[model samples]
Every structure is written in C-alpha cells, then in structure tokens.
Target: MNQATRNVLCMTGIKKSFSGVPALWGVDFELRPGEIHALVGENGAGKSTLIKIMTGAYRRDSGVIEYDQKSVAFLNPTEAQAAGIVAVYQEIQLVDFRTVAENIFLGREPHRFGIIDRRVMNTRAADILERLGLQIDPRSVVGSLNIAHRQMVAIARAISFGARVLILDEPTSSLTETEVSVLFNVMRRLKSEGTSIVYVSHRFEELYAVCDRVTVLRDGRNIVTRSLSTLNRLELVCYMLGRQPEEVSKGVTAFREQSQNILDRPVLLQAEALKYKKRLDGVSIEMRHGEIVGLAGLLGSGRSETVRALFGAEPLESGTVKLEGSLLSLRDPHDAIAAGIAFLSEDRKADGIIPELSVRENLTLAALPNLTQWGIVSRKQQNELVERFMRRLDIKAASAEQKIHELSGGNQQKVLLARWLCKNTKLLLLDEPTRGIDVGAKREIQQLIAELAEQGLGVVMISSEVEELVEGSQRVIVLRDGQSIAELSGEQKNIKTILHAMAEGADRQEAVGK
Candidate 1:
C-alpha cells in the first residue's frame, strides 16, 4: 500500500523472443517489499516468459533487472535461488519417488561430516510444513500425496531457500477451496514477514481476494498496473483480455425450441455415485445424445475430476459408468477410447499433444490401431484420414507433417479435435478445451462443439470461460467438491443459471434433504 517504498524487485525493458517470435516486448514489472503482486493476462501474454527470464530459466534478449537496488544476472536456476529468488510453478516439477523431506531440501540437503542427515532434513521439513499450516509426514513419498499437498511441498521448498521474492504461478488451479484458503493464509503470513510475492493466476476472483496490486499484459505487452482497490473483476478481465468488457462481442445465448428435444433422447452416458479419492466424492451425472453438457464449477470444484473419471483417466473407486445401456468398466484411457469416448485434457502442453510428433501423427495417435494393416501402419490411409479431418475442421497447418509444437495453440487444439473425430468417437470429454487459445479459434471451437452435438455426438465440456460454457452446452452439470450439485436443463440453461448452480450447491442438497 506504500507507493513511496522502494521496490524489492524491478525489471525494465525486459524483452524475450522464442524462435524469432517476440514473446515479451519491453515489459516493465515491479514487486514491492511485502505485497502480493499479480501478473494476469490471457494465454501467450508473456507472463510465463517474464517469470522464466526472472527465474533464469530463459535469458532475456534485452533487459535490466534490479533486485534490492543492485543489478544482477542469473546464469541458472541455482544462481537465482542463491540470490533469494524462487518460483513455484503451476505444473509442479518434483521427483515422485522422493520423500516430502527429500523434495523440500532437494539439491541443498543437510550433511554432517560427509554423511546425509535424514533426521535433520525431516525435522526441518516438519518445521517448514508447520509454518505453512500444512500437516503431512515428511517421510511420505511425494507421489502418494494429493495435488494440493504436492503444491504445498513446492511452496515449502521455495520458502526453504529463504527467498526474499517468491513467484507462485497458478498455485490454486488444482487445489480445493479449503486448500486455497490455506495457501492464502500462507501468503498473508509471508507478506507480513516482508517477503514480496508474485502471484499468477487466471481465476480473477482470487486476485481480489489475495493480491495487493495487479499488472495486466496483453499480446506480449504490458497494458496497465493497478492496485486491487482501483479495479473491479470485470475491469481487470477487460484489461487482461485487451478489450472493453462491453465491447467484446457475446455469442448467441437464446435457446431454440429444438434444444428441449435433446433431453428426450437416449441417455448416452450415466454415472451413479461416482467416487474417486480426494478428487471426486460421490459425483453422479448423466448425458444424452445430441446434447452438449457443461460441467460448471469453480476452481477445484471437481469439474475436471468428474470429466477425468468419465474419460477413464482417473479410476473411480466406487461407481458404475453405463454407456448406451451397457455397463462399462474402463480402467485406462485406451479402454475409454475403445468404448468410443475421447478426452481432451485441460493442460494441452502436458497431456494433449506429442510435441515431437507431427500434427498428423498426433491426430491419428488414438486411431492408429484401426489404421494399421497386419501390424503395419498404412501411411496413405493415415494421410487420407488426416487430410479429411484437417479440411473439415479448418485446421490451419503448413502440412500434416508439421510438428504439433510448431503450430499455434488454436491449430494444435483443432488437431486434438481431429484426433477424437478420426476415432469415430460418440462421446467427447472436453476439459477447458478453449483455454489459452485465441478469440477467433475459441469461437470456431464453440461452433464445432455445437455442430458435433447436432450430428448426435454426446459432449461433456468443462471451461472456466463462463460464456463459452453457457453458449456451448445445452445442459449444465454443476459440481461442488467433486459432487454433482445441480443440473440446469431445458429453458434454465444460461450463464446466470449455471453460475447459480455452481455457486449454490445447496439447491441439490435441499431437494435431497427434503
């Protein structure tokens, strides 16, 4: 809140380019001594690039970094950490085989007379965990812990370095509401101790709740830096999206008469009392043919978990999934795919595409078994199928042989769509499919979802973009804490209605309670 105080970290004219494409263009950023500064923008807005440069993961083409009023250049992450800078990324990179204590003190383990001190490290880990208000056994394997616990471990590791400036990138993306509150409490404690924090997240509600000031970037350029008190949620979104909230064109939301007819169709996929460990809890939902079902929930509301369960990526401990009047047991992704179900994950870079493979190869990956002739792939047949869907979906690619990583996010998403379509899939589980793509591509994908449903393909789509969810889905299934809370169908399917269902879980509880 004190504008007169000197900045703890400041970067001026920070510029970076990837493959000759400019990612950050003369960006300016500043972090005060003890304030939570948020970096927000739509995907490809240079937030990650800026963080990478600051954390020594990427060298800036041109920039001046001033930390504690001394110009510094970090040669590597080690050097950055040595200089009291640590970044806790959204996608946590930790060795699962290692124990929590080992991960917390990785690369900087305590040693006594040439012997690694496990007892000392575990004691330190316990102390750090206590500071964060997290309760976990230090000797527990990292893989055994849930996503939220893993994130806390990452935070503890960052704080263990005694870093003055900490970067938290989408820290609450995979965490439950309770876990998020714990994280916020940790941030407050850190801020109180004069530790500057850089918070990056897409969820705007969190910005006002936790951050002190926010910096908006758009198309690799810094747009504005404003205090949280100076901006509202809509204004902040408008800034990050590079458009006026009122100027951005909204899609047609009016439901047609034929939309109601979709409900009368056969129940395509149904789950009863779907329960998965920490992620999903007693969730149940049903979808019908010619229906685009929207999974609506806040961050960590088990929206994606529910879809993952349906797609068979995450096994359900206790539940029955019936597809088209057939009781199905899907243990893995292949099983779900064989049952004519396809999943488009939220984290496209990690789960959706194979960067080393060509667009055609990625598209035909799931359908390869069918395309093979006597254990040999028919290139001619593969090319034909790829070309057909590429053309049909209007996927802009230099050629089918082009590497998927080389294409834009939108094109890559289209290629992913082609993957499922090529498989002759009947049900599509889309988790944040439009996320990180451009506006034009977002609209195209939305239209494609509608078109696919019109052709009688069942869709269960999850999106943080409320407008997209409301417009793309005919029926909305709202989840709260991995449980189905409300089903908005027929004339009640709208953004307002879906938000109500998502925000108020008690509507379903009231009915059951009665």
Candidate 2:
C-alpha cells in the first residue's frame, strides 16, 4: 500500500436487514492507507452496524467489501482477524478475571512443545505497553484496573494482532485527556506504518483533532464522506444530523412541557456531597419534579459512578440522599427500589437484561413482588403492566413473549426502559439510555424522558451525546475526578457554558492538587 495513493478498504452498496428491519441500506465507504477516517452519526446511525458487517459480526444482505483490492466475505470474527481486520468496540469485551498479558495473547498464545508460553507472552505484552507509553503491570488482572486502563489494554491487544485496518469504536469514551493523547500518538505511529484507521466518536473536537477524513451517516444511510479539511465542526454536525447548521437550532424549542403537576412538587431525589471509592470525589446533585438533571464530563470524570452511588450499586463512603425532605435508605438496589428510586445501568447486556428471558419476563423481573399477592404472582397484573410500558416505550417485538436476545439493540434498550417503568418510580437514574439504539429509537427514548419529567417523575440522565444532554437537561451538573465542580441551570444552562465549566474545573482541581 502506498501512503500517497492506495485504497486499503472499500465497501459499496452494503445492505443488511434483521427481522424485516434494515440496519444498513446502500451504504458506501472507503478507508485510505495511512489515513485516519472518522465515522460520525447520532445513536443508531448504522455506525456500529456497518462496522460489524465489515468485521464479520453480521453478514451483509447485499454488498461488496474489498480489502486490498480483493473482495472477501468474512464468515466470523476469527476470519476477519485472519484478514487483518481488528476492532476495539465501545462496550468492553475483555474477560475481567484474566491478566493483561493473558488477554492480549488469548486464543493465540505462543507455545513451546504444545505447552502455553507465559513468559514470552508477558515479554511481548510488556513491549507493546511500553510502545504505547502505558505504565502498568502486564501480569495485573484486568478486573483490578480502572475503565481507562482496560480500554488501553483492548487497544494494545488489537495492535499486537498485527491489524492493518484498525476500527476503534468510541475508543476515548472513558479516557482522560492525557490517556486520549497517548492513544492519538499510538494511532499516528500506526499510520506511519501504513495502517488504515477508522475512528468513530461523538466528540467533534476529537474528530477534528485526529481524523483526516470524515463520513457521516443518518438513518442507516451514508450522508457524506469528505476530507476533514473541507468541513468545520458545525458543518459536520449538520451533515450527521441530516439538517442544516441553522436548522439544528429550530429543534431546541420543541422541548416544551408535555405533562402537568410537575413544577410545584418538592425535590423527589437529592444527593449531597456524595463520595464513592476512587471513582467519585465529593459530588452533589439534585432532581426535582418536571425536570431532568444531566451529568456531563469526559470519560473517567466519575459521571457514571455518581449515578451508581445514588442507586447503591456503588457504596457511598460519605454522602446523604433525601427524598421529599426525608433521608432515604439505600443500602442496596432492593432498598433503593423500595424507596421509589430506579436505576438503568450502563451495561445493558451484563447488568440490565437477561438473555434467556422473555421480554415481558425481563420487564417485570424487578417489580415482581408488587405484581404478586401473598407470594403468588398475579399473571393478569404482570401482563397489564408489561403491555402498558411496551406501548409507552414503543418497544417493537414479535410479541411480549419474544426472547430479549432476538430483538434489535434498540428494542432491547426499550425493554430495559420498561423494566424500570414497570416499577412505580418517583426518581429514575438513566445511564446512557439511548446507547446502541437506532436514531428513531434514540429520539423516542429522549422524548419519553422529557415526558416522564413532565409527569413529575424526577430524572437523572447520563449520556455521551452532549447535544442531548444540553437539550434535555433542566440542570446540568459537571463532574471531574469524582467531584462536582459546577452546576448550570435555569438561564445559565447551555452546551458551551457547561463545557467551559468542566474544563475550568478540571484545570483548577489539577492546580490545587499541585
């Protein structure tokens, strides 16, 4: 491959459908040698779906994929790996119990006389970590490392596989600024070696900094693919959204109050100076009726951990939560739910849904006690609640009895939403509720959150989409290094101001520590 003029990978007219719903339609894309290409779109713009098709996770319905001028059909992930296609997905996929070296060499460990060679694997892992400028013990268990370190390990593993085409899906979602810089340096090094990298992220600043070309997708279709030098952030956002830059402002006013009896009510949920382990410092936030509180920050800023602390998933060492002027007991998830608080975890497959269960079963799993009388579940009540939420959340499935594993990612997310809705919650903590869903489903979920707030159910939302956070939140709380530094609300809440506060707070905190 020539750095000046060589196409490393190309896909034309790619089409994929699942259960009558199309995820990718007539998609065309290309990656150039020694170039960093960014694929941008809102949630469910077929970004992940397109990558999965290219990497052999899903077979395209009709399309042609050419790598190195050779058309190929990858049968599985292993086949794609053999073809030098590697991906580090947004969601963590590494085994937690394994050490970093073991994870790097998994399924392909060097052997001596048919015996696994741990020493060689450890040496190679150490060398790779050093090349990446990461300081960590290769023998250390991945479970013990923070999310940021785990992400780096994933990247290292991919690079060690001798991947020629690297697909990084939201790679920096959980990284600090320093770690992100380190990753960028690694990407440049790979590019220098004639590797073609595909970068997918929602952060416009990052896209501008690292990508050489940009491709935008909307509603499962490719919108544009152009040189990064040809477009600004505003133009790129507009293209990804299928709207003009000026037209984007019109949608902001559509978020009107949709329900009643929400404004005059007292605080439904409140967290005061909450601290949790190493992830969260002193964080304080509150939720009021008819209002959604958004948590915004870079990855590792403790945004997700703050919600976990409030929901009792992460034990709070020092903090207090009050509901309606009385302190609430949150010893565990059960206690939190009993106190009228519901939490939707960020990891949907591991923490939110049970793969083997039916959609209705999963939805009613949490509130079974209430749906039962004298230790006997009332089937009628369970069905009623499930049907109600299914309609409310717009969960499209073959039936309520459909296996959750069989549905699309958007439908699965809707099922999880219904799980909390089945419980009569006064306060809801939603962590990336729109993640891994289609654009239509993402919009539906956002609208539902607004509607819930209007109905007097307080909401605490954590999202990667800054635009969503800015538009949906009545108050925005900025967290960094596990501490709440600023709150933007009422007349002061805007995207630019919230981002400025986060940056300023991080700088101040770092200076104070020095």
Best by lDDT: 1
Could you tell me how far off, in angstroms, the CA of residue 325 lies in candidate 2 after the best superposition? 3.1
Cα lDDT of model 2 by residue, 196-235, tens digit: 8999876666778889999988889999999988886546
Model 2, C-alpha of 334: deviation from truth (Å): 1.9
Report the poorest 10 consecutive residues by lDDT, candidate 1: 248-257
Clashes of 1: 0
TM-score of each: 0.72, 0.66
When summed lDDT is taken over every stretch of 10 residues in candidate 2, the lowest stretch is: 245-254
Which digits, one per residue and each the tens of the lDDT, describe model 1 over residues 104-203? 9998999999998999999999999998778889999999999988998998999999989999998886788888898899899889989999999766
After superposition, which runs of candidate 2 have C-alpha atoms over 4 Å from their true positions?
1-5, 89-161, 172-178, 202-206, 227-245, 248-265, 273-284, 289-310, 313-320, 329-331, 342-373, 377-425, 428-514
